[model samples]
Target: MDHAVVIGASMSGLLAAAALHRLFGRVTVLDRDTLPTVDAHRRGVAQSRHAHGLLAKGREVIDELLPGLSAELVAQGAIRGDLQRDARHIHGGHRLARGDSGLSGLLASRPLLEGQIRRRVSALPGVRVLADRIATGLLAQDGRVTGVRPADGEPIPADLVVDAGGRGSRTPFWLGELGYEPPREERVVIDVRYGTREFRRRPGDLDGDLVVIIAPTPEHPRGGVALALEDERWIVTMAGYGEGPGLALTEFADYAATLPVLDLHHLIRNAEPVGEPRSYRNPAGVRRCYERLSRFPEGLLVIGDAVCAFNPLYGQGMTVAALEAKVLLEAELRPQAFFRRIAKIVDAPWDITVGGDLKMPGVEGDPTPRMRMVNAYLERFHAAAAHDPELVLRFLRVTNLYDPPPSLMSPAALLKVLRGGAPRAVPVPA
Candidate 1:
């Protein structure tokens, strides 16, 4: 019977296990941290407490993997609402024109989402979770991975190995020890920092709308705020660019009071803090050119942040991981060729994320002329989205990874931008 071993019991790891469980007879998930009995924050995921949203495509992927998950989340007190109708979006100090695309999503804590997915994955036939086990290195033969060795002792043999370990993955070192060159890496760095605080939603909080206040970076030092998760709770995060310090507890309320968008600020003013603000800083935007590696080990693959970790502000990591899991399911039938297929599938999100990150003034990377043109168009598209609801929907569709970036440059979309006038103000419902 075929057995698969996945390192790191993260959302990406759990999803990898789910994908492998469908193809292999048995799947073992290994994690260095002790798995929590409840949906609570752990050391493994430092960003768990921060605000996270499931884009329309991500919601669809999760629903496909675990049927009724969206509804289940709602049953568990998560909010479900139309993306445009209920969402308050701001770009470049202007509120985006609301659209009626009916693209709705689930709002839940990262811990909650991870817990649900873990529960569902654990219930899969022949899948088991092994916590507090650290993967030290790969056991290989003839230059191909066959299993993994735990830090304590003994090797866990498997027909396939997947590294879903997050940004700090040791896959590159393990591959090098096996006499294979590491994949080419492309990195873009933006000095971004964030401080997040959760609040208990008061009556009439949000005014029945999901709050999303965003400001562009490079030019604008301060970032944005998003109110998500439980219906009665809000996770508000304040971010800053360059070397700017993130918001402090004493300053968070004051900072929120100044956003160009009033809805988020209003909600913050009326809401009561549920927890202390947590701060985090991210400087690396990485893309591993694993697909370009000519001698990648057979029966071994890397997914999620192990492969490419984007800026958290983009909120693309979880969605891209889910999309990658879906791609893995489709390619599992041909394990030998699966990595190549998965590599191609990963390109879409990588482009969207890395491309966007490169836009920051101080970020360093190679942006081909084509990429520059693409970014140029997107800038106008974003500006246009502030006025045109139809254009905004299309932009959301592409930004959410439901469609390719090229889709934003389609003839129809281009014409919309060419003919679309400057951004128009949208009046808030009183």
Candidate 2:
């Protein structure tokens, strides 16, 4: 293809642009937000102020797409530490054992991460980042997308158009207008609400750990997470589902204190607030089943949140987007092949997020027998992680998307769960 256009200059769009830059002669990325020059938040990103975890698998893909990117992040003040060893985690009402799992990633503000990638992608040969423009509609003719129509400008023509407009995308409507069936949607309403605030970090904050996580358990549905950010700062996010507590500036710390773990709340209570608290609601887990569509435009492919918006609590959005971008880099620009690849790319994240949401009372869908077994085993696995560092590493591997979820169900893992080894506050010595 000579030219490919990516709509929405979010992480997924940028990554897609980078992938296409090598194959196509020219690539263009458009976004509505006038992307800020500095490492600052933009109006387009709803969860920019929240805690974002670049899981192990995501870190690898980023480094693959932009070599030396991780180093740049760290040099620019991103904290680097073992995913488990330097972090505190509580799950299934027990603390996960701390130990080195050979997985590490940069902990930085969302803007910093996206800003760096945007700058790099913009500088790439034959790549253009156009801000202050929104894709008003798809340009289609003869069953193939011809380009995209911008809100205020003449249509930009292209051989292919990819939608990364996230969950708010209007691609389905555009498809309907083109006499094509939009992908059917699978939605599980979570009613998840979270508030985030940045805090000035000191050397001794959270006893110098990079992250303190009080994950939500069945008993205490409210949860909290704190991550060490660039420039001696921290971003703490507290979340709840259904009839949760108030998510406001005045109530942030109070909500944190109710978490299953105290370290997150304790740190935020003492740390100086650097910014006003901001809250965002992830109303549901939505997956547009594009793979199920019998017919789709040849020149159009949907990626990122435009295809599936995972539950934010899992931190799978960016990672899944990056993986899909990688797939786009290699796959032929055909609808069937593209949808198949992205479907496989999305399956893990969808299962993890959608399955978790369905477990909560009042949410939609009945858990499959296999899902019940998996969740039951995982609960035991979390309890075992308190005692067995190996089991903890295995759990982290699956959660980080480094390993398949089936790894957690291996006979060996099941035996480890049956054994239910010893317990310790910290599995590895500092």
Candidate with maximal lDDT: 2
For model 1 the local lDDT of residue 98 reads 85
Please give the lDDT score at residue 47 for candidate 2: 86
Worst 10 residues of 1 by lDDT: 421-430
lDDT of 1 by residue, 338-400 (tens): 657766657877676676667666677777766667666665676778878988788778767
Q: List the residue pairs that clash in candidate 2.
A: 387-422
Candidate lDDT (C-alpha), each: 0.77, 0.84
- lDDT tens digits by residue: candidate 2, 247-346: 4545676877788877877887767788677878888889999989998988998899999999888888999999999987788879888988899878
Best by TM-score: 2
lDDT of 2 at 409: 67
Model 2 residue runs over 4 Å out of place are 243-250, 421-430
